[model samples]
Target: MLIYNMWPMWVIVVAVFLYLSIKSYKERNAKDVIILMTVVIIFSFLTVRSVNWLYGWNIF
Candidate 1:
């Protein structure tokens, strides 16, 4: 599966967002959650681009 090789990166991205969202929830920080999500989105985009480049997927 194409996803098999890319699972690790996706897992790490999801894990980071999960951790931040939980922490923000516990602390009741709306701004932090928003910022965290924005950062995570950018990180995910970069990761996908890097993965595409690495694997010559041409998806981007």
Candidate 2:
């Protein structure tokens, strides 16, 4: 038996982050871009931590 992980969720999150970042940059919304980037970073960190936990790795 093969186990499938939540790869789709990660893809969606990354895609949305990139889209928003590019949109903000094109519109010259520096503040929004910063906020969006911060959110993306936080989510990325959480994703890594969750994956590590799921794989029985001690990240903390």
Candidate 3:
């Protein structure tokens, strides 16, 4: 149930990030792609952390 809450947001974020990454790649916007990927990685990691906390899983 907790994962249910986190998963949707994660999916949306990843989807949008992927879309942007592809778009940037096609446009040859290296800087944009790099920034977008960085943001995606950071957000994904935070999402994982939040999920672990919610599920009482210590991932240290």
Model 2 over residues 1-60: C-alpha lDDT tens digits?
011266448657867997899899999999999988887887777677667767877876
lDDT of each: 0.76, 0.76, 0.81
The TM-scores, one per candidate, come to 0.63, 0.69, 0.71
What value of lDDT does candidate 2 attain over all alpha carbons? 0.76
Candidate 2 C-alpha error for residue 19, in Å: 1.3
List where candidate 3 sits over 4 angstroms from the true fold: 1-7
Worst 10 residues of 2 by lDDT: 1-10
In order of listing, the candidates' clash counts read 0, 0, 0
CA deviation > 4 Å runs, candidate 2: 1-11, 57-60
lDDT of 1 by residue, 1-60 (tens): 455467467759867896897799789999888888887777677767767766788878
lDDT of 3 by residue, 1-60 (tens): 565467558868977997999899999999999999988887787777777777788884
Better by TM-score, candidate 3 or 1: 3
Model with the higher TM-score, candidate 1 or 2: 2
lDDT of 1: 0.76
